[model samples]
Target: MRILILGGTGEASALVRGLAGSGHAVTLSLAGRTAAPKPEAVPTRIGGFGGPEGLARYLTENGVDRLVDATHPFAARISRNAAEAAAMAGVPLLAIRRPPWERQAADAWREVGSVPEAVAALGEAPLRAFLTVGRQELAAFAAAPQ
Candidate 1:
């Protein structure tokens, strides 16, 4: 089967490696946001496909049998585009979602809807806070009192 994998995260890379020698033609797509992305196991294509229409066109033109959306969980636009493109192209789509972090008894977790909310939740008091957000979003938390 010919597979197109929308990838960037570690999970995506692992999927590519797992698919190696599986007798399927696999192509991995990267967003091109990273200055130096790790080399992938499968054939790779960098940058966006315009939008859903363009992605659908690529799927049809390349005769892509399946689409695996393995993009970062925070990439909503690409995920939406992939879903729309799969529907438009009449191709089967599968998403490899990241499992949510499990809270342990010793863990102090504060869930917030957005980065701003997280910053707001930090309060005005100066405190040592360890943020686990991606580097791209670090700017949002810069104003937090920490």
Candidate 2:
């Protein structure tokens, strides 16, 4: 059966590799939001699908028998779109999420309720900060007082 894997995460890449050399044909799609995407072991498509309509069209045109949403956990928009499109196209859909990293005893983690709270806690201390909160809140880091 032809499979379409909406992939951009490490789990996606590993899935592709694990399915590699198998008889099933797989097509992986990436959102192309990265300036430098890591290499892939399978065929890939880049960019958005315009919207649900476009996605349905693609699924119909490609004759995709199955869809696996292997995008990052935070990619809610694409996940919703994929679900909608798969339902609209009457295609089987599955979500393959990676297990989150477990904290080790040596790891010291601080949980903050909000972005502003985290920023406020930083206070006037001059220190380098790394923000990996995704692109939506990238400006928050820039706006933080140094």
Candidate 3:
């Protein structure tokens, strides 16, 4: 069976490595969002297949039998698009999501529902905050009250 893995996460690479010596045909797809996407252990293809319509078309054109979504936890757009396209094309879809890291006693965590809220929670004080959420949400802290 032809398996297309939507890979941009570590779990995806692990999956690819695990399935390394298998005879099943596997193709890993990436969105090309990064200048250098995480290296893949399996064959990879970059860029989108347009949108839902294009993905559907590709699924039909390539005879893809299965889809494995191994994208990042916050990659909602591509995940939604892939699900819609998979359903439209009548292909089986499997979400290979990684288990979220749980905060432990050794770890300090301040949980907030939104980025704006997190910024507000920081209060009007000059403080050193570690922005670990990623580059996209780092802007929220730029105008934080001092």
lDDT of each: 0.92, 0.84, 0.84
Sort the predicted structures by TM-score, highest score first: 1, 3, 2
Higher lDDT: candidate 1 or 2? 1
lDDT of each residue in 55-115, candidate 3, tens digit only? 8888889999998899887787889989999999999999877667787887767788888
Candidate 1 contains a number of clashing pairs equal to 0
Cα lDDT tens digits, model 1, 1-146, are: 99999999888989999998899999999999998889877889999999999999999999999999999888989999999999999999999998988889988889888888999999999987777687789898878768
List all candidate RMSDs to the true structure.
1.6, 2.9, 2.6
Say which candidate scores most in TM-score.
1
Error of 2 at 51 (Å): 1.6
Candidate 2 lDDT for residue 12 = 88
Can you give the TM-score per candidate against the true fold? 0.90, 0.78, 0.81
Q: Taking the tens digit of each residue's C-alpha lDDT, what string does model 2 give over 31-114?
A: 998878887767888999988778888999999999999998889899999999999999989998767667899765566887
TM match of model 3 to true structure = 0.81
Off by over 4 Å in 3: 101-110, 126-132, 144-146
Residue 103, candidate 3: Cα error in Å is 5.6
| Native-to-model Cα distance after best TM-score fit, residue 33 in candidate 1, in Å | 0.8
